[model samples]
Target chain A: EAGVVQSPRYKIIEKKQPVAFWCNPISGHNTLYWYRQNLGQGPELLIRYENEEAVDDSQLPKDRFSAERLKGVDSTLKIQPAELGDSAVYLCASKGNTEAFFGQGTRLTVV
Target chain B: DQQVKQNSPSLSVQEGRISILNCDYTNSMFDYFLWYKKYPAEGPTFLISISSIKDKNEDGRFTVFLNKSAKHLSLHIVPSQPGDSAVYFCAAGKSSGDKLTFGTGTRLAVRP
Candidate 1:
């Protein structure tokens, strides 16, 4: 089976521009997550979905960040008017609660 | 405040020696713990996991040990190799909470 897939492995945007990333989770996996990893730090969960509903989004910044898992198979995370502080790797992962399989991630650089 | 902590930022071990990584959590409600390994430019991959009731779980040369009373856990790699060098992360979660709290991570460098 194919692992989780993410598009646009790398992205560069202006400080005020908007950017979006896409994720396709492994087939049959029930849980999906979006994470942000800064340099020298472990991933921080930004949002989590169980099927089409977002079960956890407390860590997501509502002002500039939004995520949707339409129909539950694929997901999209968007950041509007990005800031320099947003430069980091955005990762998508899928699993069945305990163990997760991750995508390579999209490296976002806001200049 | 950081709920999960990995005090050691990095570790170096001989290729044939054992490598031990440690983690501590502030939440006693965490009923599950996991370890993940990540390489540069790649996302983390699940290494192993242990449930709260169990103190130890072993898979091949990798072993995870939990000390629930102390809210601490550890991962041990026996007969370590150069290929095993990577960043190790410890995560904790409750059965009811869908989100996981991750540690800062410890970089393990296994040298030949």
Candidate 2:
């Protein structure tokens, strides 16, 4: 079975520009998560989805960050008017019975 | 506040020796813990996990020890190999399927 898949392994955009990242969870996995990892730090949860519903998203920056999981399979995370501090690796993961598998992640560089 | 923390930013061990990475969590509600290994430009891969009910869980070369009372956990790799060099992250959650809180990773360098 294929693991979680994320598009755009790397992305570079100027500050104040809009950028989007995409993810496709593993088959039959009902739980999906989006995390951002800054340099020298661990991945922080941005949002989580259980089936098509976003069950947890308190950590998400509502002002500029938005995420959606359609049909509970694929997800998209968007950042509008990006800032230099937004540069980081965006990781997507899906949970099985116990373990959560991660994708290669999309590295975003805001210049 | 960071719930999970790995104090050691990096560690070096000679090949064929043992490598121990430590982690501590502030959340008492976290009942399950896991360790993940990552390489450059790659996502973390699940290494091993242990439940609150058990104090120790051992795989072939990796072992995870959980101390529920102290809220501390550790990962031990025996006879470390050069290929084992990578960043290791410790994570905790309410349960195995719950959302995880991760600690700043510890980069381990196994010198052969």
Candidate 3:
């Protein structure tokens, strides 16, 4: 009955550096999602995966952002040449398509 | 392009009083609505949810009221406490299993 888990709860990187965040969804949950939360803003969906298939990623910045959930249970989100504007919290969530549970999130600060 | 909106950037409520937070959505296709509460350095936690079919749903001290016709929904916290101070986000889910669209959060400050 563990909740969704994410790694590197906090990260600080320089502008134009590459950064990656990881997530492990709850056991038996088929739906996984990654979201970005800027200061004073709600979490925005970057990508959503249903058992290794990316069902939605329209919000992801394809030019520098890429995600994968090939194994389905765990997923990774990466941003290349990160910009200062990318400084925000990356939250990982899992659901049964019924209820969502979020992880502690990886807070990235790009200077 | 922001479909879900929480116009109130923040709210200050005295403890032990009712704390009401409001949200509005433009998309009529959104059938499921949810509320999430988050503290600093943490992810959002589900507070309550309501379906389009129901006008209200209640759990303990938290209640969610939906007005589909007006495209408005609200969360009422009775006897608010200091612990209730956090950012609350309202999200809408489409009927076709599409991803949720969330509003800019509203920060609630309950003064003791």
Candidate 4:
């Protein structure tokens, strides 16, 4: 089966602009997650979804970051008025009864 | 506070030798643990996992050992190969919550 898929493997945006990343999880997976990884650091959870419901998004920056999984099969993470600090790799993953599978991720750079 | 930590930022080992990576966690509630391998410019891939009930789990040449008393976990790669060179991250979670807390990660370089 195909692994999780993410679009726009790389993106560059100006500060104060808006940027969005998309993800398509593996088939039949019931859980999806969004994470951010900075240089020399591990990936950090930003949001999680069980089906269409966002179960945990406490770490998400509500002021500028938002995410949604309408049908639960795919998801999108958006950042408005993006700042240079927002530059990082945005990863999306899906999980079933076993381990979670991650996508190639979208590398976003804010200039 | 960071619950999971990988103290070593990087490690180097010869291809025919063994490579050991260590991780420590402060959360006793975490019942499931996993190791992930990541290459530059790509997402992390699941390597191995161990449950709280078992002290050890082995798959092929990779083995994961968990010590509940010490709240420590280690991943061992026997006869390490150059292909094994990558950043390894340790993650912990509870079976009920389905949320994983990840460590800072350790970069391993296997010399050929």
Candidate 5:
């Protein structure tokens, strides 16, 4: 089976510009997560979805970051007016029973 | 505050030797611990995992040891190879499906 899939392996945008990242979870997986990894740090959870509902998103920056999981299979994370600090790798993952598989991730560079 | 921490930023080991990466977590409620291996420009891949109820879990060359009393966990790779060189992250969660808190990661360089 295919693992989690993410679009645009890399993205570059100027500060104050909008950018979006996409993720398609593994088939039959009901849990999806979005995480951001900054340089020299581990991945931090941005949001999580159980099916089509966002069950946890407390770490998400509500002012500029937004995420949606439609049909409980695919998800999209958007950042409006991204700042230079927003440059990082965006990872998507899906869990089935125990283990969560991750995607290749989208590396965003905010200039 | 950082819930999980890998104090060692990097480690170097000779091929055919053992590599031990340590991690400590501050959350006592975390019941599951996992280790992930990551390469450059790639997402982390699950390496091994151990439940809070178990103290040790071994799989081939990788073994994970959890010490609930100390809130510490360590991953050991035996007979390390060049292919094993990568960043390793330690993560903990309350349950198998709960959100995991990760450590900063330890970069292991297995020199051949």
Candidate 6:
């Protein structure tokens, strides 16, 4: 089976511009997650979805960052007025019963 | 606070030798642990996993050991190969929670 898929392997935008990343989970997977990884750091959870409901998103920055998984298959994470600190890798992953699979991720750069 | 930590930032070992990576976590509530391997410009792939109920789990040449009393977990690669050169991340998750907390990761280099 195919692994999780993410769009736009790389992205660059102005510091105050808006940016979005998309992800398609594996077939029949009910769990999806969005994480951000900084240089020399591990991936941190930003949001998690069980089906179409967001079960855990306490780590997400509510002010400018938002995410949705309306169909329970694909997901999108958005950052409005992106900040310089937002430059990092955004990874999406999906899990079925045991292990979770991840996508190549989108490297976002804010200048 | 950082709940999970990989103290060693990098490790180097000769091919056919054993490579051991350590991880320490503070959350006693975490019941499941996993190890992931990542190459450059790619996402992480699952390597091995261990549940809190078991002290060790083995798969092929990779083994994961968990010590609940010490709150420590380890990944061991026996007869390490050059293809094993990659960044390894240790992650922990609770059975009740949906999120998984990960350690900073250790970069391992297996010399041929």
- The per-model lDDT (C-alpha) reads 0.93, 0.95, 0.92, 0.95, 0.96, 0.94
- Residue pairs whose backbone atoms clash in candidate 4: none
The positional error of residue A24 in candidate 1, measured at the CA in angstroms, is 0.3
True contacts kept of each: 0.80, 0.80, 0.78, 0.70, 0.85, 0.78
Q: Evaluate model 6 with DockQ and give the value.
A: 0.74
Candidate 1 regions exceeding 4 Å error are none
Instruction: Give per-residue CA lDDT, model 2, range B1-112, as digits (tens).
Output: 9999999999999999999999999999998899999999999999999989999999999999998889999999998999999999999989756789999999999999
As a TM-score, model 4 comes out at 0.98
If the candidates were sorted by their DockQ against the true structure, best first, what order would they fall in? 5, 2, 6, 3, 4, 1
Docking class of 3: medium
Q: Give a tens-digit lDDT track for model 3, residues A1-111.
A: 788999999999999999999999999989899999888788899998889999899999999999998777899999999999999999999998576889999999999
Span of ten consecutive residues with least summed lDDT in model 3 chain A? A92-101
lDDT of 5 by residue, A51-89 (tens): 999999999999999999988889999999899999999
**What are the chain A TM-scores for all the models, listed individually?**
0.97, 0.98, 0.97, 0.99, 0.99, 0.99
Better of 4 and 6 by lDDT: 4
Report the Cα lDDT for candidate 3.
0.92
Q: Write the per-residue lDDT of candidate 4 for residues B2-93, one digit (tens) a residue.
A: 89999999999999999999999999999999999999999999999999999999999999999999999999999899999999999999
lDDT of 2 by residue, A11-105 (tens): 99999999999999999999999999999999999999999899999999999999999888899999998999999999999996878999999
**Judged by DockQ cut-offs, is candidate 2 incorrect, acceptable, medium or high?**
high
Q: Give the per-residue Cα lDDT of candidate 4 at A93.
A: 93
DockQ score for candidate 1: 0.72
lDDT of 1 by residue, A1-111 (tens): 999999889999999999999999999888999999998888999999999999989999999999999998999999998999999999999986347789999999999
lDDT of 5 at B30: 96
Tell me which of candidates 4 and 5 scores higher on TM-score: 5
* Candidate 2, position B66, lDDT: 92
